[model samples]
Target: MTAPDLTRRLVAELVGTALLVTVVVGSGIAAQRLSPDDVGLQLLQNSTATVLGLTVLILLFGPVSGAHFNPVVSAADWLLGRRTRSGLSGAEVASYAAAQLVGGVLGAVLANVMFEVEVTRLATTERTGLPLWLGEVVATAGLVALIFALARTGRGALAAPAVGAYIGAAYWFTSSTSFANPAVTVGRVFSDSFAGIAPGSVAGFVLAQVVGGLVGVALVRYLHPEVGEAAGDVVVPHPETRSPS
Candidate 1:
């Protein structure tokens, strides 16, 4: 766990985010083609694929990058670890966010190429509204709180399936279909498909998600004040051990 190891961790984050976006965008495109007239069926198919794909990705990459494909998740991890020896440095957090953003965009591009679609088109699916924003806050808050809660309770092992299942359920329960990850949100902007979000809507969703992330952190503070024996552990190797800073 040194500078070279940090690079590997960042690569894992990048690759994991990229693969996740591929699953999301690819499945959405497939759902659109398979159920042209059935919106509900399209959603069903998309959500199912995302759930299974996400679970596998987390299990596959968690040990490498903590499987934090989401920017908010990385921030949360850093914040939670600030007082501990395992916390991520500011530089590492920045690296993770950058890698995830780049990865997400690449994933969208790969998905588009595989599906024979325009490679860099912007999404036009308008998802603007207070209700949807509220849904985003709720979805994101629940996600952040759930992840930290699990770690706080020494249940990191349950993260793969639990996190995946929560996202699949949130897709149905939330108005905006739970575009909870900022990197994922940015990635979806590159595709005009069932899972895509218009550029105009991205800011609002990102803002709501940020607010939700803050709320989630507060929730974790109140709900699990003391970090368990495994409190500082992440899905991947602890950042303090790998980061050069």
Candidate 2:
């Protein structure tokens, strides 16, 4: 299959990340407004919207960019496929991360504006401590492990719903509400709402996520040693421009 142009793939990543953050932040705001007294109910509403929105976004963008709205996923793809030269090149990985980060920030701003909140306000929600950090680790590790497992086992077709389901479940199971993606974590810093994360906690969460991603890659290598070729299809198989090695 012919690969998509690099520009097009970047656009897909940017737009997909943007929409994903929009869903998360927007839903959080809506949930807050609708369930002013019940935190659990607000979380339920937010998670449900996120699950649905994420599934649709993946299905929509998977054909174009594999719908990897997470930087860790992109980095994992590169690390796993480096020896086989089947996944993204270093330059491509860098570009993908940049686009995702920018998209995440833009998405947050868009969500804030849509909700009539101040666009530049930083989040004040103080999410810190060992439990939260550990939660981030577990959440990110599981997410990476799941995505790669699906790719390795020829289950990429189920990624949309499967991934969305995992995130929804993690939201409740994890302590930090499962801020698994770094881009999304950073984006949340821009919104001081129910979904937001304070700037002080970003570093810890991001570090834990990175560690979790490495652990996830290790697990994939141990469990599916022979399926490295499928690394290019992480999240979902999409047209990819393999850079010159």
Candidate 3:
């Protein structure tokens, strides 16, 4: 099957990214007032919101943009060789990633203003600790890997719930509480809300997320060689990577 138009796909990605960021930050505000000590409750609340929000967003835009709201997922798409010579152009990838990045920043700003949040620790400034940072890297890796591994089924519409479920379940299993999304991570920087990341810690989190993306791609490439037909055709429009077929 042919890929959707590149422009539309990028737009879809940005839109999806925006929505997911909103949920991540928005929920934090709601939870802070609900219960301060119950991290588990906050997680359940956040993950449930994400699973539902993601399901709707994907169902709404997956056909148009492939719903890759996270940069890591986009990176994985190229790494797995999913794009074709005719898939999204290099310009499209760059533009799409840029859009996602800006959209994420915007989402964070909005969350801060909307919820009256104040970010205390931005990125590496906070001592979430090396262990926490590493955990986030691995948690995010599993999330994206699941997408790369599963998206090829071509039935991702129905498969979205599985996506939501895995993410929701991963909440309790891992220490990082499953950040799994770069856009969401960036967006969290704006809020001093419960789930928000410290600004100082952002660098470590992003790096870990990127590494996790690669790890997920490599594992899936080896584990699911039959993922998508467009694995190695290299006619990439993006200078950095190839499109997924």
- Name the candidate that leads on TM-score: 2
Task: Sort the predicted structures by lDDT, highest score first.
Answer: 2, 1, 3
TM-score to native of every candidate shown:
0.94, 0.98, 0.82
Cα lDDT of model 2 by residue, 102-139, tens digit? 99999999999999989978999999999999999999
Clashes of 1: 1
Better of 1 and 3 by lDDT: 1
C-alpha lDDT score of every prediction, in listed order: 0.86, 0.92, 0.66
Tell me which residue pairs clash in candidate 1. 66-236
**Residue lDDT tens for model 3, 3-27:** 5556666677777787777877777
Off by over 4 Å in 1: 1-4, 228-231, 236-245
| lDDT of residue 78 for candidate 2 | 92
**C-alpha RMSD values across all candidates:** 2.1, 1.0, 4.7
Of 2 and 3, the candidate ahead on TM-score is: 2
Model 3 spans > 4 angstroms off: 1-5, 82-89, 118-127, 153-155, 228-245
Predicted structure 3: lDDT = 0.66
For residue 156, give model 3's deviation from the true position in Å: 2.9
